[model samples]
Target: MTDRHDVVIVGGGLVGASLAIALVRQGVEVGLVEAAPAGQMPAVFDQRNLSFAAATVNALTALGVMQQLRTPTGPIRRIHISRQGDFGRVRLEAQDYGRATFGQVVVARDFGEALEARLDGLSGLTRYRPARFVGFAPDEAGHRALRIADAEGERTLHARLVVAADGTRSAVREALGIGVDEHDYGQTLFVARVRATQAPDGTAYERLGDDGPTALLPRGDRHWGVVHGVAREQAESVAALDDAAWLARLQRAVGWRIGRLVASGERSAYPIARVVAQRLVADRAVVLGNAAQTIHPIGAQGFNLGLRDALTLAEEIARGDDPGATSRLAAYAARRREDRERTLAFSDGLARLTANPSPLLKPVRSAGLVAMEAQPSLQAFLVGGAMGFRGDVPALCRGEAA
Candidate 1:
């Protein structure tokens, strides 16, 4: 007989690592495989950040990852959404909604390293670094056999369940015969860390221009993470410009809300696409995170939604006698449909609408923003929904304050 575990997780990125930690806490023996052993750690001065909604924060807290973060985490007191060449705008304030803050922003590298440290201390968990998933097979006995290859040789692991958190181009999902519907926006997203001439003061801003959506999200020490989308044809030109020229162009589109956008660090650009798998499950194997669905980064919902997937799966595993049973998988799929559809539609719609240069959309968008901003009840719903508080939210996402 070979070595066996309760679950085998393929991928050790943010979502997969968190899932492993959560399951291990429940006393389930877990085996995690990562292609890169001791993946490159974040540099000291790195400042890329992620905007965490309240629900996402709650999820992290439950996994004990938040407790280790120790940087200048700032609350998102307000959000400003506006379109250039339009006379209307929408504003959401936490104070108006009787909440302390809408969300908080944390440096991505910091958060990732902290989670890695926690994973190191985890018990009942076996980690296979510098290893990759070559293939997997399953039987009617409700067990999965995984073939993993590494520097040493090949080994097989048997588990009651298998999770594919391997990202957008998932090998496991492909092995399960699951296909993804991909929508290429014909655009690219540029992300960078910058020192704004003005203080963000915990305010997140989004500028929707004919070009695309440009967001300035706050980070620690007055730094900001700027994410902007540009057409594929235009992205190269934008990325080719010097820092000074780039800052000038960015500030012109965003207005003078946060003062001059000064120094910028290493910049990275990636093609944007919306990917949704036809099915999320196959036998005893299931896909989560980017494997099941990969959406545009419009509202920064990609990773947040993935976190919810992990949390929901954890809840089921923690509560059920047989975690990988057919009934349990069905329940997970049912519970995730509403939120997934809502987010997918919102992201795709926003991407298409804002990228449209049509003169006819001007009036409609203007009026819509104005109305959305003025209605208190409607604003409340938008705020809550944007912060990942809607649909069938799991208990851990509520920040139980334990």
Candidate 2:
């Protein structure tokens, strides 16, 4: 096997890249394996907008990752959530809770570019691009012998830990023999950048309808990031719509919240599903990000949760000399349990409950919304989660070193 590194991360996307940054900053030896070619962004880096929870912003800020962004991010100062044809609504202002803002929004493509720029500055890090993780086997040195493939051929690299940040359908996780409990939301999401007659005022809107939830998030470019969810059977029809027709449909769903949806930019669609790995750690290998849990995006919790995974794992690694020791991995799993479970349940439940139009559930749903509006404690609970302070938070989340 090749000379060992402290850790070898497969799937250098958002979570993996962040993990590499975190680990390297903490003085850990790191090898980053990315499937994309050199000088190119990964596939996950696209036009989709990522909502950075307060904690995420803090952690990335601590790593100096935010400074690398070429574009400014939109701050979420207020949030509005309401159901179509429903009697209740919930409005929250960060100022009401003594916070300046709940979070910020960054385009996935730009965020990816920023992550690349940040990663480049770390001269000690090893990057294997245009490469794929073939498989891993036990090493005599108590590490994993990873088979990595590139343009030349396959080569073996040993590492104390192997991370499957490979996303929802992780080949690394599968190679580790990890099974997942999966849920298909039966909903397809359409994403785009749109401009409204009235410019955004730093407020994000979630208009829930029987079809699904249509969200309008403030974007730094004075436009809005739109994520419109619809039933699977209707997805094709919506996908085939012309830009004008698409904006019209989006306008109908969003109502007058953001004013007229006058124009739209590039649009894309994909089905949403929840895939939770049954276990986080197996021997010297572990999963992070979507490999561990792929929750619905109704509340923009997916990436934030995955980022927490990276931060928590990084914290654990810093806590021990042997990064892949069984005791350390177990501790990492323990620290992640509460946050992971709560986030997964929150995202899955919110998506199902809000999109469900059953008359019986309507009153309960409305009552819950009303209570959230009237009860400060309840709203506190929500803002706390959205701000990334709910459970066992990593040091980076608290704006401290890991």
Task: Give Cα-based local distance difference scores for all models.
Answer: 0.83, 0.90
Residue-by-residue lDDT tens digits, candidate 2, 138-192: 5767788889888878888898998999989999999888999988988999999
> What are the clashing pairs of model 2?
none
What are the per-residue Cα lDDT tens digits for candidate 1 across 1-402? 245788899988878888898889888899998876776652321445688888888778777888888777768889999988987888888888788788888887788777887898688999887888888745537688988987778888888889999998999899888999999988888888888778778789999877678998877667888887788899999989999988888888888898887798888887888889998777877899989899988878888888888888888787777778888888888888888888888888988887788999988888888899888887887887788887888777887632
- Which is the leading candidate under TM-score? 2
Candidate 1 RMSD computed on C-alpha atoms after optimal superposition onto the true structure = 2.1
Query: Which residue window of length 10 is worst by lDDT in model 1?
Result: 39-48
TM-score of each: 0.96, 0.98
